[model samples]
Target: MGGSGLLGLEVTRQARRAGQRVATTFHTRRPDGDAHHLDIRDRAAVIALVRAVEPAVVVNAAYLQADWATTADGGTHVALAAAATGARLVHVSSDAVFSGAAGRYDETAVPDPITPYGAAKAAAETAVKAITPAAVIARTSLIIGRGDSQHERQVHALAGGAPGALFTDDLRCPVDVGDLAAALLELASSPHAGVHHVAGAGAVSRHELGVLIARRDGLDESALPRALRAGSGLPGPADVRLDNTKTQALLTTRLRGAREFLASPLPVE
Candidate 1:
């Protein structure tokens, strides 16, 4: 694995608990438990890491969208690593890959991204598929769960009295971190290989989700401003909600709805 972000860390921890031999890399924040430092951008280093670990399956949560690039080149690093090692690769992706002009999207839809980040991710997906047809690409939406993910951070900020306007028009499917991790693990282990949508069951706007969080935590929803619709500032789809019918049928685990996904237990192991 590369880039030990929240998703990476969660998947790593799950794999470890399941008694799978797990080896991962870290760039900036070296995880306290056990992690090495390997920059995916360095192709030689990626190849070296793969050879050393000799993993049968590799789940790449390493992303560089917010920084180096978002889409095409961003995912190339991990794809190359998987090819070099002959490991089945599971590349986590995002709903942002679509323009958002069209609300819900499926694996078959042509990627038309409006943001640099989305375009980069789309590029990465393309590269991964070109090299390794069997490489799995899982696109999802606003993922929520432990360790200060965007969603958790927002909640924390709210709890700490941070004031901001939540956009009701901004829609997404926010899957819990744990549930997403489980789904990814299943994909890695199974024979299913292709682009999939691994996210929560239902769709919601940011403002609506904020209200749900507030209600769950007993926070004051009235304090929050009414939701508002906003544009991408670029030509693109609006909803871009993913259809997970394929994922639901293929994987043993069932992705939950947002509410149920949130109400579920946190990692205890």
Candidate 2:
């Protein structure tokens, strides 16, 4: 694994449980595992790391690098390294690759990103696919876990008397970090090696999700009123729901619904 982001960290943990020798990198806040200081953009460093580990499979959970070229080119580097070492690659991607203009996106959805972050991810996806179609490209949506995330912070602040507005227009299928990690790991071992969408089983608007969180935490729904409804004019995706039929059918672990994911009290590693 590369980078200790929420999903990356979860993937690392699951890999350990699967009895796979796990090696990860961290910019800061290293996890309780074998970690090293790595900058993915450094092709030589990535190549060296893979070569040193001599891993049978390489999973690039790290995306959204400091630079666009870093992510785009770094993906190419990782893919090439995997090919060079004959290691199967499992690359994590994002649902932001699709334009908001479309409805629910599935495995066959054509990527049409609208944001720089999304564009970088899309570019990296292309690079990975080009290098090896056998590589598993797992795309997901807003992952919720580890209250340290911006989304969780927003929920916390709203519950703690911080009045804010959440867009009602933005709809997504937010998956739990752990669930996504498990699915990706299963994909790594499965024969299906292509782009797959691993996200929450159900789709909910941002406002609805806020309401669910507020209710779960026993917060007054009136406190985050604007966040619970679509009113005025908010520019955001109406719906970016991901169809996980393929992911559910092929992976060993099934994704949890956003409500189930939030309601279940899982320890954040």
Candidate 3:
């Protein structure tokens, strides 16, 4: 569904690497080399594109712009369109679907979204599932990589010192974007349906994770600010570590932790 976003772009890259013909969508500021502009909010446009492509597999990595429209409603539109064409559907989801009231979430956990973005993602899962029961919904967590990831950007933002603090109470099992992309491509051809937790094997607070990354990347950990989460005004839960055993058992790809990935000589994906 999405062709230019982080996941979409990587999926396209890996798929092409594996020698599959590719057709992808873009939003505003179309990417170079024949990327089609797709306003998923316009259901007719979405349907037209899917019908024209008639791809064997459609992976939905589009997210978070117009949460209600692009994510929530857009996912449903893609599902309906893909379903009608009898294409296998792989929908990328988020662990934020839970309230963070608890942790170690699996496929069985009922969604209790607390934040607006989380609520929108939860809505998308609901609509996609109701319309396409056979679709695979991969609920993952914070995406971390070598370049301008949320973690790397936060580190740079705090290099000169920013306001507030890097959250120490909020926890997530950050996933390598490449591992996630690989797993999605594998599942697209499989029969895994409902929800699957695809994330890092280890759980750590954001502050802890930042410190680890800084230390591993040769940046001073002291350069980053730190604070414990203590208010309800915050957007998300205190914990959202995913149980990746299902994912591990399901695929040969191993989703390593930040410490593991950062420690590597060559960071893949």
Candidate 4:
């Protein structure tokens, strides 16, 4: 539904490139081309939109990090609407659902959220599963894009003398946005049901990721400060890696690790 966001935009683009008639949605920011303005918080509106679109497959990539109604309850609303319309659903979830207590999480690992955002995502997963047993709840980690993602932007800002250091202790398996979107589309058309871990093959700390981004963007890596997330009082997990072994086997889309994807600089436009 979030056709304006990073992953959503790529999904829409790839789907259309493959000859799929796509109908996108946005919340606050309006996206280019044909897209519906949807407030998923309103159950009635969500249902009406889904019914009007009559899509064969529904992929919800919308979520507000701080809003419970949008992340948790809104996911349920989409599931309910998708179920009512008999459309296949793929709900995007996050590794935030894990507390990093297990260090690594597989598709079968139960969620143990340590932050509010994580809890909300966990709750959404539970609701989506109950409402649509056949729906795919795809949990992912940091989504890295080509110089446009938040993490990449942050690295650039730090290189330009912005304050704050990237955490060396906070580890994640950052996936390429294109790979993730492709994987999601593949899952949408596949027989896979329930939770799936779609993430990168290699795990790297936040600081290391920042360094890779800096090098790729032609910035000075030394300018990017480094710190430990452990005593930084950050209210999130320290190391939560998604095990994409099972899901990777089911799809042809390769989820490239941050090191591999960011290994090269962006091509000149």
Best by TM-score: 4
Residue-by-residue lDDT tens digits, candidate 2, 21-45: 8888866667777888877888888
TM-score of each: 0.91, 0.90, 0.94, 0.98
159 Cα displacement, candidate 4 (Å): 0.6
lDDT of 1: 0.77
TM-score for predicted model 3 compared with the true structure = 0.94
lDDT of 3 by residue, 60-92 (tens): 988873468888889989999988898889999
Q: Given candidate 2, what's the lDDT at residue 211? A: 76
2 versus 3: better lDDT goes to: 3
Q: Which residue pairs clash within candidate 2?
A: none
Could you tell me the lDDT of residue 99 within candidate 1? 80
Candidate 4 lDDT over residue span 185-260, tens digit each: 9999999999999999989999999999988878999989999888787798999999999999899999888889
For model 3, the superposed segments whose C-alpha errors exceed 4 Å read 265-269
List candidate 2 stretches off by more than 4 Å. Answer: 225-236, 266-269
Off by over 4 Å in 1: 69-71, 159-161, 231-238, 264-269
Clashes of 1: 20
After the best TM-score superposition of candidate 4, give how far the Cα of residue 144 lies from its true spot, in angstroms: 0.8
- All candidates' lDDT scores? 0.77, 0.79, 0.83, 0.93
lDDT (0-100) at residue 160 of candidate 2? 74
